[model samples]
Each structure stands twice: as C-alpha cells, then as structure tokens.
Target: MKKNKAHSALLNRYQKLINISCDLASELDLNILLSKIVRAACEVSDAEEASILMYDPNKKTLYFQAATNLDSQLKRGLVVPLDGSIAGWIVNHQKPIIVDNPQKDKRHFDYIGKITSIECKSLLGIPLMSKGNVIGVLEVINKRGGGFNKEDQDVLLALGAQATVAIENSRLFLQSDLIGEFVHQIRTPLSALNAAAHLLKSNRVHEDQKKKMIDILEAEIEALAEMSSSFLDLARLESGRKQYNVKEFDIRDLLIVCHEIIINEAHKLNLLFILDLPDTLPLIRGDRKQLKQAFINLLNNAVKYNKIGGEIILKAIAEKDRIIITISDTGLGIPEDERSKIFEKFYRVKSHRDHVPGTGLGLSVVKQIIHGHGGEIDFTSEVDVGTTFTITLPNEI
Candidate 1:
C-alpha cells in the first residue's frame, strides 16, 4: 500500500509538470510569463516560494526579475553580484545545487535576505540555459515537508528548461512588436524633415519664409533626437535589461530636488508650483534615480498640459505601510474615453496632439518605472477642470 501511494504521488507530479509546460508555451507577455513560471515552480517543487533571477550579460550581474514570496516589487531590480552569491555560481558553472542550510553555505548572498525579509532555510537552484547560453537561475526556497531531494531537483530542472525557452520567445516577440511601432512613429517626423528641407532649397520663397522653414527644420530635428532617446529608454526598460541602483532615501528630499529643478520652467509659463510635504516622512527602499525620473515625468506633464497661470500642487502623506503622493494640475484634463490608453506606448491625447510637441512615450516610461518599483500610479481627470495623479509607494513605517 505504501509503494502504491508513492507511485501515485510521483505520477501526479509529472502530470502537473506536463500541464505547466503547456501553459508556459502559450504565454507571450514577458512579465506575465515570468510570474506564471515562478508560481508554477513553487507548485511543482512543493516549496514555499520560488524566484527567477535573470542574468544581464551587459552588466555581468544577476537581478531578481520575478518572485513568489516578495510582498512588493522592491526586490525586482535588486542586484546579486557574481562573486559570493549562489545564483552567480549557478550562472557561472551552469549546474544545479541543493543546499539544505543556506546559513552554512559561504556562497549564499545574505544581503538579499535582508532586502526581502525572508529567511532561507533550504534552497534548490538550477541554471536556466538555452541554446548553449547560460541565461539565468531558477530557485525554489524552503521546501515544505523536508529537504530538497533528487526528485525535486529533477522536476525543477525540467521546468527551468521549458522556462528558458518561453522567456526567450517572449523577449523576441516584444522586441519585434516594439520595433514595428517605433518605425511607424518615426515616419511623421521624417516626413516633416523632408518637407522642410525641400522648402528651404526652393528659390521661390521669400527670405522671411525661408527663416520660418529653417525654424521648422530645427524643431523637427530636435523632436527626432528626443524620440530616439526616449525609444532607447523604453526598449531597455521593456527588455528588463535596465539596471537599478537600489538604496534607501527619503521621499521628501527627492520631491524638493524635483521641485527646485522644474520650478523655473513652471515660472516661465506663469504657473504656480506648490509643494506640500510633511517635515518628517518614512524612508523607502528602491532605485532612487528611477523614482526621480518617474516623478519628473509626471511634474513635467502637469506643467505641459496646464493652461497659463494654472496651479500645480504636489502633496505627500505617509500611512502605516506606504507613502501616498498626488500631483494635481489646474489645466486641460484628459478625456473620459482616452483615459484608459494614457499609459499605452505612443499614445497621446487626440486634443493635445496638434498643439503639443511630444513623443507620447513619456507616460509609458513613467508607468514602467513606477510599476517596477512595486508601486501604483493612477489619475483622475475632468475635461477642462484639471487632472490629479496619485502615486503610492510601499514603505515600512
């Protein structure tokens, strides 16, 4: 009877693995695909939590891309160096390891434990390889009933193999999709450049008209340059290759810095800039530089979309476990129908497209950064009444 029960459990696990393999093959969204892979890892391995650490060849480092145990996205971009890290060793040697007590393993990265606030008692890590290339590591932590065994290793290795292929396919699909959209977006600016050049070369125009044509050329050139830079930024972020330098910093100070930098520009438009922040606030963890970029993008938008002499209000408050920020502007608000697409790539408000000079990529970049930090961003707008954007970042207060 005992042998029969053991055989049935083994068969069930393999069956579960087969179903997961089919599920992974159909997913094309990189983020969703990764989440599914990790969750599946936990279910099949009978572990408490699972994580996927992807290797960035350009940086020669590994970063936490997805995890089942993390409470927030604070650990997503946390870097694990190749030296003195188990994940790094797996990537370097391209093999599997079963460490029953990570505390005794000198190769363990204890900093990660502190960052995620999760203790690692047992760990089973496998290298995710594809086409002779070491791509990343798949790890399941703290097996439930007992230490990791050969069966657990066998199952995780099988999952990792399928996961690596799925990841590569998803990345390729994203790149192709983004490239097509980018090509479509640049055609308008290119045509404007061509038209300006043609008008400048003709002898039939007055000197004043020629100056106007030169101005047009300069503006279009500037727009194209900005578009190129923003495109690269979006691509890197979407590909998950962007490295974040994580540190603990006060949100209040970051807000002040942003206000100081943009206040002059707001003044040029005869706008009022107000910063309402508490004297004392909790310090948050994450990539400070990326968070700053996210804030600056929203602030710039508040200014850009506002009417002359409009008011921009920046307020912050700390709750028990999170910080809330709202940037309100008394300007042209987004339309009801278009609000859903605001964060989509290359999407611009139909009303503002003609009068406003923009690439429509700023908000997309902003959304990516905000979400990557394990935060949420939302906004409320009324036509001509104004718009207010709310951001919430996780904190330990």
Candidate 2:
C-alpha cells in the first residue's frame, strides 16, 4: 500500500509538469518560450538552475540560448564543442543522463563554469529530439535539495517532447508567412503591366504623347518580367525545391564584378564607390551567381537610397571560420524597430516607402539566397547614421 501510494504521488507530479510544458510550448515568442522552459525545468526537477542549449547545425556547435540563474545575454551564443562535454554526450546519444557529482565525471566540461563563474554540482540533461533527430539539449544543474531521480528524468523527457513540437510549429508558421507575402508582392508589378497594355491600345493620345506612353509601357513590362523571374527563384530556394550550387570563389573578384555592373548607375548619382578587400582572400564556397545577385541587390539599394554626392563602401574580411562581407552606405538608415522585419518578403522600412520605390522583395530574396547557402544576413542601422548590412558565410562554403 505504501509503495503504491508513493508511485501515484510521483505520477501526479509528472502529470502537472507535462501540463506546464504544453503551456510553455504554445508560446510563439522565442525568448519567452526559452525562459518558460528554463523556469519549468527548474520547478519540476527541483533544481538550483536550468539552462537551454540550442544547436546550430551550420556551426555544428551548441550555444546557450537561455538560463534561469545566469546572465542571459552573457550566456547567449556561448558555443560548446560537440565532443567531450556532458551536453554534447546527450546530444550525440539522444538520451537522458543524471550525474550526481559532475566534478568526478570525465565527460563534464569545466569551461562553462569558467565562462559563467558558477559551480555545478550535479546535472540532469536530456536531448530535445524532433522527428527522431536531436535538435538541442535541455539541462538542470545542481538539485536544490536531493539529487535528481527517475521521476525527474521522466518529467524532463516529457517537457522536451512538448518543446520540440512547439519549436517545429513555430518554424513552419514563419515559413508559411514568408511564402504568403512573396505571393502578395508579385501582384503590384502584374497590375502595372496590365495597365500599361491597356493604355497602349487606346487611340485618344497624340503621336508624341503616345510615343512617351510606349516607353513607359516597355519599362513597366520589363520590370514585371524581371520581378517574376526573381520571385520564382526565391520561392524555389525558400521551399527547398532547389539546392544551392556551392563552390569556391574569390570574394574580392565577386565585389569587383558587382561594381563593374553598377558603375554607370553609381556615376549617375555622383556617389563615390570604394572597395576594401584583401589581396589574397580564402576561397568561399557558395553559389557565385546567387551571391552576386544578393550583392547587386544590396548595392542597388545603397545607391537608390543615397543622397547626391554620398558614398558607398564594400568591405570584406575573414573572421574565425566565417567570412564577413559588409555593404555600407551614407544613405538614409533604417529605423531601429523596422530592422527586424526587413528580411520578411515584401517588407520595407517605413522610412523608405515614400522616398524610394521597390518591389520590397529585394532584401527578402537576398536573405533567402544567403540562408540557402547556410549563411546569415543581418544589419545594424541608426535612424540618420546610415545602415550597414553584414553577411557571414562559412569559410568552407
């Protein structure tokens, strides 16, 4: 009777934990979801602290995304190797582990203690698995009272399952939203083309006026055709219908090609163009044509948004195992809040909406192409200080 009672109590506790996990998983905000997971893990496991490590597949490293007791910003982006660490072991095995004394374990990594300046006594880690693959590791360090037990392990596993489902759902939702926006963006150009065709057919205009109208019609038609082709290419890359053609190419030479292609336009604006690239750059593996298109789109934006007599700079450097390329301009900068949405398909900073004309798919297409190559594109801008777009691609490819 006593044993049965004990088992039932444990089961009830686990049920409550599972319910909390489900609630946390429903959150779409990445930061909130991470915080809730850490809090729930600490509560259910009765641990002193909890931390979530997200796996970056491109870097093949584990990074701290959130923690209950550590400095959140300090812990963020702290990378851990894939070998010789407890978290790494869990990731590799896709299983749960409970260590009562981490100091005695050969697999325990002491580097985290040095980084966070916190001593770890015990640890319970479980792999966050989705679709039969490990995405990351969730861990509770130093039980508050006694050591973690089988019930704790079971509860954490259940929580991991819920978190995985939620993460997968959020990713899918983001992708769907992007595709919808892409579809909506193509409509504007299509409408312009239709109007131009209708005007050309009208006979009310004089010969000189008709000739000018024909020119406008031709330009609009060409814009529509170019936008359609670019949109289709972006859609294929985003939907995984097409794969990146990765290869080794010189970064400097690529920038020179972009400058050569856009030199006339730069001259029209009277903008001084500068290129700062090293004489010998390591070979970067990526689709050369796609990357060139991304550069051209960014350079075009710089030129389009610049005031007369402004300057544009193309800079490149090798950082760690990644190559960083930046295109900066003395043109109008993006607003702080608007920076986040710039990569969304058909999204343009409100500041540029009236002053500049674009299909709004340029940055989105750039983001997709960079992401397809397993790289990242981000920017920093001050309202009047100007914007600089930084792209980081792996040195290997």
Candidate 3:
C-alpha cells in the first residue's frame, strides 16, 4: 500500500510538469519561451539556478543563451569548451546526469564560477536534442532542498525536449518571413521581361525600335540573373547553410586591388578616385573573395549614383583589435528616414529609384557577408554631400 501511494504522487508531479511544458511550447516569442523554459525547469525541479546553453556548430562553441538566477545579458555569449565540461559531457553522451557534488566531478568547468561568482554544489544536465542530434544542453545547478535525484533528472530531460521543439518552431517562423520577401522581390524583373517580349513581337516595330527592345530584354535578363545569385547567397548565410572560409590577408593590398579595378569606371564618369590606406594596416581574418565582393558592391554604388566629375575615396585604418575600412563617395546620399531600410533585402531608397539602376540586393548581400565573418558594417550619409560605408573586422589574424 505504501509503495503504491508513493508511485501515485510521482505520477501527479509528472502530469503537472507536462501541463507547464505545454503552456511554454505555446509561446511564439523566442525570448519569452526561453525564459519560461529555464523558469519552469527551476520551479519544477526545485533548483537554485537554471541555464540554457546554445551550441553554434559553425564556431564549435557553446554559448550561454539564458539563465534563471544570473544576469541574463551577462551569461549570454559566454563560451564553454566542448571538452572536459559537464555540459559537454551531456552533449557528447546524449544523456541525463545528476551530479551531487559538482566540485568533485572531473568534468566540472571552474571558469563558470569565476564569472557568476557562485560555488556550484550540485548539477543536473540533459541534452537538448532535435531529430536525434544534440543542439544544446539544459542544466540546473544547486538543488534547493538537498541535491538533485532521479526525479529531478527526469523532469529536466522532459523540459529539454519541449524547449528544443519550441526553438525550432520559432526559427522556422523567421525563415518563412524572409522567404516571402525574397519571392516578392523577383516579380519586378519578371514583369519587365513580359513587357520586353510584347514589344519585340510587335509587327509595326521599325529596325531601330526592334534594336531598343532587344536591349531592354537583355538588360532585364541580366538583372534577373544578378538578383537570383544575390538571393541564393543571402539565403545561405541567413539559414546557416554556408560556412565562411577564414584566412589572414593584407587590407592594404585588397584596397589597392579595388582601386585598380574601378579606376576605369571612375575615369569614364570624370570622377577623381582616391585611395587613402596606411603603409602598415593590420592583417584581417576573413574570406578574401567575399570581402572583395563587398568592397566592389560599395564602389559600384558610388560610381552609379555619383554626379559627373565627383570624387570617391577609399580609406583603411587600424583600430584597437579591429581594422576599419571606409568607402566614401561624393554622390547622392540616402535620405535620413530610408537609411535603416537600405540593408534590408530588395529595399532601395525612393529618391534613387529614377536616377540609379540596381536590383537593391547589393547592400543586403554585403551586410550578410560581413556578419558571417563576425564583423559589422555601417554607413552615414547626407543628401547631396556624400555617403560613406564603414566596415570593421577583427584583427585576430
């Protein structure tokens, strides 16, 4: 009779835990869902602290994403080694572990204590698995009443499973939004192609008119091709399907190459081309080809939008732990309100619509490439004064 009563109580606790998890999964907001997961884990398991560590497979690092007791922002992006850590062990084994004494455990990482300034006594960790692969680890530390037991481990594993599904759902929602925008961007080129075909087929068209229609068809085709390529690149980067090939390269030499490549176009427009690079600019670690593409996009825009006989300047300098490269053009600048949307996919300034010709994907692609290298790109512009694009990359190479 006594054993039966104990089993009944355990069943009731399990049912309540499942109900809480169901509520958590219903949340569509990612930040709120993460917070609820950790909070529910701590509440159900009676732990002093709980944390979620998300894994970045590209970087091969585990970063703390959220926590219950610690300052949420402070714990975020704190990387832990993939070897000889308690969380790493759970990730590798794909199992739940209940540690009564974390300090006595060989796999316990001491660096965490240095950051949080708290001595961890007990820990319970489980792998956050999706589709049979470990995406991260969910852990609760310092059990409140006594120490973590089998019941706590079981509850944490259940919570980890629910959290994984919710995270995947949120990511899918975001991707669908981006895909919809990309689809809409292709319609303009398609309409132009249709119009060109109609004009070319007209029987009354003269030879000169026929030639002009052919040029329009060719231009539309080229624009479609360029837009398609940019769309693919952006999708790959945003979906985490592409990995950067990082290497050390000289920034000075890269600028020189860009200057030489665009010199002819500058001359055609009667624009003065200036290259202001230091003799000892630091080496930057990134994909050389992608960086070149980013620079070319900026230079192309400068030439396309500049007034005749204006000047375009490319400058590079070394800052602390980073190399800053700026490309400035005395061209038509973007309006203040439209500046924020310039880096968005298929977003172009309204003022430049009639004056410049582009697919509006150049800056978006450039931003994605720079972000893939763990860098940042920003710009400042004043109408009719000039626009400047500034890129900053780590000098870790």
In order, the Cα lDDT scores of the candidates are 0.90, 0.79, 0.81
Among all windows of 10 consecutive residues in model 3, the one with the lowest summed lDDT is: 70-79
Q: Against the hidden reference, what TM-scores do the models get?
A: 0.94, 0.58, 0.68
Estimate, for each residue in 111-182, the C-alpha lDDT of model 3 and write its tens digit.
767656888999999989999888888999988879898988887787778888988886687578767987
lDDT of 1 by residue, 1-397 (tens): 9999989998999899999999999999888898899999999999999999989877798988888877435577778889898999999988999999997899999986785678899999999998877888999999998999999999999999889989999999989999999999999889888877777777778998888888888888998899989888899898887877777898899999999988998999999999999999899887888888889989999999999999999999999889999999999999999999999998999999999889999999998888888789999999898999999988731
- Write down the RMSD of candidate 3 (Cα, Å): 6.0
Q: How does residue 27 of candidate 1 score in lDDT?
A: 97
Q: Candidate 1, 131: how far from true, in Å?
A: 2.4
How many clashing residue pairs are found in candidate 2? Answer: 0
Candidate 1 clash total? 0
Candidate 2: residue 69 lDDT (0-100): 74
After TM-score superposition, the amount by which residue 94's alpha carbon in candidate 1 deviates from its true location, in angstroms, is 1.7
Measured on C-alpha atoms, candidate 2 has an lDDT of 0.79
> Per-residue lDDT for 1-397 in model 2, tens only?
9999989988877877768866876787555677888888888788889988877566577766678876543345446667988999998888899999998898988876774677898899999998787878999999887888888898888888887787666667656776687567667766876876676677667778887877877776776677777777766555333434455688778988998887789889999989888886787766788889999999999898887898889889987788889999888888777777888766777878877767677887888777656588888777666678999887753
Per-model C-alpha RMSD: 2.1, 8.3, 6.0
Return the candidate ranking by TM-score, descending: 1, 3, 2
Best by lDDT: 1
User: Poorest 10 consecutive residues of model 1 by lDDT?
Assistant: 69-78
